[model samples]
Target: MIRTLPYRTAAVLAVALAVAALPLTTAPTAHADDRACEQYLHSKKYQIGPRVNQACRTAYDRGKGPNREAICKEMLLKIEVKPSHAASACRLGVKP
Candidate 1:
């Protein structure tokens, strides 16, 4: 039993570490996606098209951060906006 204690503790620690890391690993993807969405929203070319821009703006206004971000990414990707610029366009509003 004494010998097994260290092994059990190690196992528990390993599981805890893995669980903690899961979110961190997945966070970048979401961030990148959201950034892409924002950029698409702000681009002059996309803005020139009132219909397209309005739809995106409406969605962004209505959506929570995650949803807006995802939609932004989706729309930008659909329109072939470059990923690097996408994030800048989808800038988040600062709430008071």
Candidate 2:
């Protein structure tokens, strides 16, 4: 017994699978993923790893208001070493 999806259905499925394989942060922009954040952390002697990445993702997701850049800056400033502020800075056009 052999069954195959219609061409259109197969095309849709393929598109869905391709989209699914993409990194999760593609939508709403990947602000939290800019490499400058990691560089900033490294410059500050913080290790560029999971905790920092998680913090950035959290900050980006939580960011709100007409000034998401400012919101991100405020959030990151409260944390001393763990959160990287470079992405915020990059978005805000300010230095981290």
Candidate 3:
């Protein structure tokens, strides 16, 4: 029973290590996505100014996947902005 006790303890430790690593594995993806979104909005600072820039960022936060990109594009279009700006901005915001 003493020898078996060591084996059980090692098994418990290994399981604990794996469980701790689980949450960490998914953290980088979300963080990277947010950074990408912020960088995209930041890039448009000169062309859109603060108001539209904030609007674009808000739209991006509210959206997900392709829908998020679409929302940003729509916001830009509503303001009658340049097509190139909208397209590139939305593309970067939604990029993985």
Candidate 4:
């Protein structure tokens, strides 16, 4: 019974430590993802100022995959860019 108690306590402690460290592990990864998304938007020449920069960043985050054009078009329209311009922006930013 005494030996079993120590083993159980160690198991609980290890689990607690792992749970406590979870956020620390994910925060930097998310921040890095944000930066990478921003850099990609900049490389596409879309972020001309603060307003466009935010929109481009958001578009990149929300629309970086197979449906990127449709997703980005919806988001860009919220900023009042013309439909043609938004479609062109989406088409230009990604490779086929």
Candidate 5:
């Protein structure tokens, strides 16, 4: 039992260290992507209005980057707006 105690202790410590490090490693990458999505939404055009932009931003912040892009692209298509509209809006510092 005494000999086994050291092995058990080392195993427990290794598991604890892994669990503690996992979130730290993954959180920053997730946050950076979220920021990118927010910036993209705030800069996108297409006449999406403030409310729609805000909704998109919120959605992106809530882990919806891929979905947000799909929705925004669909909206642009439905409204007959060009992608350049979004590029211009981003350049002009517009929030819609």
Candidate 6:
């Protein structure tokens, strides 16, 4: 016994399948990821490593540490990182 989809039915199914797969066929916009983090580290002369990359991701995700001075203060007080370096690195771009 042989069965086959009618041409119209098969065409409709093909279109439906294409539509269903459309989303996966395209990529979403990039997020704050590796390149941005690397730039942040390099611009500030920070050691380029996993810890620093994590810090960069955290800094970006937390929108640079609660407030402008928070990460700088935390780093200065707790991590023994210089405030100037912390601020320069954590803040990313908006100068000082």
TM of each candidate vs. truth: 0.38, 0.34, 0.48, 0.39, 0.32, 0.44
> Looking at model 1, which ten-residue stretch has the lowest summed lDDT?
29-38
Q: For this target, which candidate reaches the highest lDDT against the unseen true structure?
A: 3
Residue-by-residue lDDT tens digits, candidate 2, 1-96: 134457778899999998897866465542344355556666777665665554444444434344555554554555565334445433533222
Worst 10 residues of 4 by lDDT: 29-38
lDDT of each: 0.54, 0.52, 0.64, 0.60, 0.49, 0.57
Per-residue CA lDDT of candidate 1, range 7-96, in tens? Answer: 999999999999999998877433333224445455545553554464356345644554664565456566676665444554441111
Candidate 4: tens digits of C-alpha lDDT, residues 1-96 = 989999999999999999999998877433323244335545655555565555444445544666765776677677676677666655544432
Can you write out model 5's per-residue Cα lDDT over 24-94, one digit (the tens) per residue? 88774323232343355455533446544544444344354445555544544455545665333222232
Off by over 4 Å in 4: 1-47, 54-63
When 5 and 6 are scored with TM-score, the better candidate is 6
Over 1-96, each residue of candidate 6 has an lDDT whose tens digit, in order, gives 134457778899999999999998885755545345457557766556665555555556546545634543354335445566666566552232
Task: State residue 25's C-alpha deviation in candidate 2, in Å.
Answer: 26
> Local error of candidate 2 at 64, Å?
5.2
Q: What ranking of all candidate models by lDDT puts the best one first?
A: 3, 4, 6, 1, 2, 5
* Clash pairs for candidate 4: none
Q: Say which prediction, candidate 1 or candidate 2, comes out ahead on lDDT.
A: 1
Using lDDT as the yardstick, the better of models 1 and 6 is: 6
| lDDT string, candidate 3, 16-71, tens digits | 99999999886764432434544665666645466566545744574454477677
Better of 3 and 4 by TM-score: 3
User: What are the runs in model 1 whose C-alpha is more than 4 Å off?
Assistant: 1-47, 55-59, 92-96
Clash statistics: count for each candidate: 8, 0, 0, 0, 0, 0
